[model samples]
Every structure is written in C-alpha cells, then in structure tokens.
Target: MDAHLRELRYFVAAAEESTVTAAAARLFVSQPALSKQLRALERRLGFDLFDRGPRGLALTSQGSALLPVAREVLALWDRGYAEARAAAHPHQLVVGMQTAVGRDLQRPAVERFRARFPSWTVSLRLVGWDDPTAGLADGTSDVAFVWLPTAADLATRVLISEPRWVALPTAHPLADRAEIPFELLLDEPFVALPSAAGPLRDFWLAVADRPRPPVIAAEATAADEVLELVTAGVGIALLAEGNTDLYQRPGLTCRPVPNLPPAQLAVACRPDEPRKEVHHFITCVQP
Candidate 1:
C-alpha cells in the first residue's frame, strides 16, 4: 500500500502536535476529519502510528521512524512541484483574489504587467473567502489580492485603503440614509464569512467595535453569496467602499460606516518567494 501525500501530511501534523485538536487547527481541518484521515493512513500502512492516552498522543516506534522520512518526502515534493510548475508554465502567473478588485486596479495593473512582460500571461483565480490567504498558503497562487489582517507569514503591501461600507437591501429603512452610523446597525442580523476565515471574518463583522457579537443571519463563502443574501434581506454585510461600486445591483444599496476604521486591500506573496515574476506583478499593482 502506498501512502498518499495528504495522508503523510496528516500523519506528520499529528505526530508533531501530539494532539489531534491542535493538528486539526494547524491544518485548517476539523478534528474528526483529521482523526479519520490518520486512521485511514494507519489502516493502509498496517501499523499503529500513535499511542493514544489521556494525556495526549505519543508517536509509536513505527511512527517515530517514519516521521523523518515523511518530512523529507514532503519537503522534496514541494520543491519539485514548484520547479515543475515553473518549467511547464514559464510564461504564466496565477493571481488569486476573493472579490472583484475594481477600484480600476486590476485592469490597469494587468495591462502594465503585459507591457512589462510581453511574453507572459496572467491567470486570475477567484478563491472563496474561506481561504483568507487566497490560495497563497496552499501554493496555488503566485500572488494574491487579499484583505488586510491576513496570515502574518506572508509579505504584503497595501494597494488601497478605503472606508468600510454596509450593503443592505434597498427596502431597508437605513438604506436611504446618506451614511449610517456604526452604532445604529449594531443589533442587525449580519451576513458573516465562514469561521475558517479566522480574524478576517471578525474584521468584516466589525467585532472590535461591537458591544456583543453581531447576530449572524447566515454565513457566506463568497462575495456574490453575501450580496445575494443581502438582496434577499437575509442580512446586511460590511464591505470595503470600492466594492460598493463594483457590486452595485438593483435591489442592493451600500452606505459608508463613518465610525469604523478603513479597510485595506493588499498584494500578498510568500515572504520568501523566489520568483521574480511574483514581485513584478506586485509592482504593477502599486498605486
């Protein structure tokens, strides 16, 4: 039986953390899901990986011996995958984004990038809000347009800073206001981002400014769903001002939240990224 990379990763995480709960958090997966994968891996290998006790998990003799080998395999695979992607897609750059980067940034930046690197092609990948790094953490994106308060390990530069705004159904009483005070909307049911989004979700919900947790009408993993829910009067959502213009629709209206701090849009890449193309793309997006 062959051990898949994902299984190895699960095993490695479990071994290092010595607790399934901690390992699950580190891997951004549910504890039960991680436990299931670890069990499946043990079944395939026909050996016990860990000695589960009340205190926590301890690696078995077989697991201890396999740990180093698994780490090495993962490291080698990551390096090889990067090298192969560069070789096969030498002229392409993948940019991951969660929402429409409207403020006239994306088109102009892409144009500038094309002019600078005439032989290169750009691929825009729309990632769900659940992955706050916008695919950067998974190595699927060469660069990303992400909201502020992202993972600390990634390098980021602010591209735009704008006031936070609220998206409400047109029929809502507050929709007619020129601008709504943050305090006025405190008790309203709000559309929230998935819990997987971590602090990014808190930022959108204005958790810091709230007296208590805002009522969650529903959760959405994408900007479109948030807007759709708002249109249906399911809940209101907080968004950046630029998005107000970009996502304007007949049944939806957006207004500024004067008391809230501004939101920032930034270009992020792995801090140690070696690719010159990634840096070049960052340059193109600079205001």
Candidate 2:
C-alpha cells in the first residue's frame, strides 16, 4: 500500500512498546509525533491499528497481524540499505576462491597490487567449489583464483603449474609409499568435488581418458572437507602439489602422483567487462 519502511518501524516500535510515550523514547521522537505517525499509517491501511485503553494501548486484529509483517519489512530494508552502502563506497578488489589459496602466492600478489594501486583494497571471497569458475561466472568477484579449464568465456593468466598429489590417511596401506602412479589410484574410492565443477572435476579424478567412472566416497566443496574425509579414512583425494604442504596435517599424508597431468592455478576474469583494477592485479601475479 506504498508504506515506507520508516512508517513500518514506527508502527512496529509502537506495537512492541504498547504505549506512545515508551515508543517515542525508544525511537528518540516526541510522543505527539509518534502518535501522529501511527495515525497516518492506520489511515493509509484503511484500518484502526490500536485502541486507546486507560492503562496503555491494545492492538486491533489488523494491527496484531501487521506487527510481525512490519518488523520483517524493516529488517529486510535495513539489510538492503547496508549492502547498497557498501557497494556505493568501496574501492575494493574482490578475489573469489574455493580452496586454500596459499599465502605464498597471495602475499606476493597483494604486495605487488599495493605497490601498483596504493588507493585500492583487496578482499578474498571464499565460495563453494561446485562451480569451477569460483564466483567469476556470476560476477560476484572482480577476479577469481581457480584451477585450469574454467568456463571458456573467462580469460586467465597462470599463477602456478604443479603435478597432482594424492592425500591419504596416514594409517592407510599405501601411505608408507613415497609416490604413486595415476593408474594405481583408479580402483581406490575417492572424495570428489561437485558435479557442477565440470571438466575440472574430471581433472582431479584423472578421468580424462578413463573408460570407467570413479567410485566417489564422498563429495566436498572445500579443501578442508576433502582432507577431513581422507583423515577419517573415508577415501583418498587429489590436490595440487603446491597446496600439499599448505594443507599438511597429522592424520593425512600427501604423495606425488607422477602419471597424472599437472594442474594450473590461474587468476581468471571475464574478458568482456574486465575491470582496470582486476587487470592490474593479474599483471602483479603473472610470471
């Protein structure tokens, strides 16, 4: 009925306090002004919101029904306002990721970005690994830290290229071995990323040319979950060797897999609407 959130807030505060004096004190408005606002709101709704009682105030049926609805509207408006404010004010560079992007890479990149763009700030946004492009596909990030073979629409600059490694429970039979062949891991049940990850999921599974499907023990969206599943002996998983040391843990051990194709870590962004800041950040990380 074209009611503003400010009116809804006044109505909700009045309803909760059950008296104009208390509502005015809570809202920092005069008692007469609060009473006038409530009267206007009721007139807009074509209803009497409250009845004046000797002791305090009592809601009519319409006011009782509208109390929660008004509170909800006020809460939603507050959240939307905060989001718009952040969007309007920031000179931020949001980099999205799905895994443990090592500080080894991040520190260097950010240091260079600061030197190049002193007035800017950097933000790291962790997203679910289900989407292979991280948040770049949907424009949630100015750029993304993702594995190779992301959505074809994105342009990328490589960061690190490293061989795949397998993380296994320390107590597993094969954990004592120094290295393993890609063929050996075929029969082992493995933890996998979500199906929406597309070809990147296949790369981790070493399934580019394999005829048989992987026996997925569990699905995970982040590196920690994969390591946890392995530590619990749920199954083994593949990860880039560069991250093997970063994610090292007592219960899990990672070993090189020599036969699998190496993965490329890259900073990716949409080529069509590339931001100048994102381009500068990419140049900082490029070899």
Index of the highest-TM-score prediction: 1
lDDT of 1 by residue, 111-215 (tens): 989998999999999999878988776677888999988744689999888999999999999988999999999999999987667688899999999989899
TM-score of each: 0.79, 0.68
lDDT of 2 by residue, 1-287 (tens): 79987788788767767888767754668999998998998888999989988877899999899888887776556445534544774577888887878847777888999888888888899987675777665456777888987644688888888988999999988888899877778889999876556577778888884669888999787789889999999999999998888898888999998867788998887665435767888887744
Clashes of 2: 0
Candidate 1 Cα deviation (angstroms), residue 52: 12
Which 10-residue window of candidate 2 scores lowest in summed lDDT? 77-86
Q: Which stretches of candidate 2 lie over 4 Å from their true place?
A: 1-90
Error of 1 at 177 (Å): 1.8
